[model samples]
Target: MTAGIDLGHPQAQAIQSDEDVVRVRQLVRTVAVAARLSLVDQTKLVTAASELARNTLVYGGGGVAEVTTVDNGRRRGIRIVFADDGPGIVDLDLALTDGYTTGGGLGLGLSGARRLVDEFDIVTGSGQGTRITVIKWSR
Candidate 1:
């Protein structure tokens, strides 16, 4: 999260079921459109949101996604925070590796999501759960 930016009140969305993950994509797309993001940017943001939301659901044992619109004076953007209260990641480096997964997934979720968004922040530890924040700025 960037300091000094004005962020609107976040709209919370659940990340429990597979359906909830789909709804998170919709929520992000709506905010991305309102922020004046280009079509490509919007797609990228939505894809990132989907990946992160799934991680929250599968790995984090369900959580919430908070979608918000933000302004940094000149540009507008959408920011999403995915948080969960499950057991946190033990090895951050391995978790971020491109082909490593604790759940037999392809292991591209975190790394791929980082590449798709303009800004990405993740916080997790052994038992601290996980919180991932992604921001997509309008061009």
Candidate 2:
């Protein structure tokens, strides 16, 4: 496990299939527990990770997820970055809105994941794929 104080190197896992998504969830849970996050916080982070991982596999056309432990002196947190080289999202706004999905899903993956984390960021363009980063801080 990487120390929270070290922000230079993060652990990464490839998200290529359903099994990969499960592995991502386990990795996130491990890191979250190691960070001494509350059970509720851990669950939130895990749920968010699972959603993002599935999105990476289903929509992003497979990618990698980087997990890192973070510390801001007084607080500790877990950060995850999901990146994939899919077709990319054409409408960011529409994608983020509730009840919107191109794959006939519940449309809660992106927006719901965002709500579960303390920080969220997304980068994507036409044919450029997508990258999403999220963080959960321990309370």
Candidate 3:
């Protein structure tokens, strides 16, 4: 959703296992740091990345993520994209509602991640797969 220019090449990784989720968190943290995000902001972005990566692996049946740095001219930011080709969410409204869980977890993955980021965008459908993009700007 950012019209901003890419600051560097995206660092991509497959989201196929629990370990990959951890790696996502680390990569996001690295970018957040490089963007000069505050410590709190860094934690929020990394947490969001963890949840989204987990969702990509579980609900999406594995996928890929790209973590990149972006600059909207005024400030630097960290952008993360999570995509999957599994069964797409049928009810996006319900999926985003807090406490709604289709995977038996706490149901905080999607909604919580949205709250943690400065910008959130998701493209999904019943059989169209899912692509989620989140960005957190450095203040």
- Per-model C-alpha lDDT, please? 0.90, 0.91, 0.93
Candidate 3 lDDT over 74-122, as tens digits, reads: 9888888899999999999999999999889999999999999999999
The C-alpha TM-scores of every prediction are: 0.95, 0.94, 0.98
Over the stretch 18-126, how does candidate 2's per-residue lDDT look in tens digits? 9999999999998889889999999999999999999999998899999998987778899899999999889999999989999989999999999999999999999
- lDDT winner between candidates 1 and 3: 3
Ranking by TM-score: 3, 1, 2
- Which 10-residue window in model 3 sums to the lowest lDDT? 1-10
What pairs collide in candidate 1? none
Residue 98, candidate 3: alpha-carbon lDDT: 94
- Location of the lowest summed lDDT over 10 successive residues in candidate 1: 1-10
Error of 3 at 83 (Å): 0.5
Ranking by lDDT: 3, 2, 1
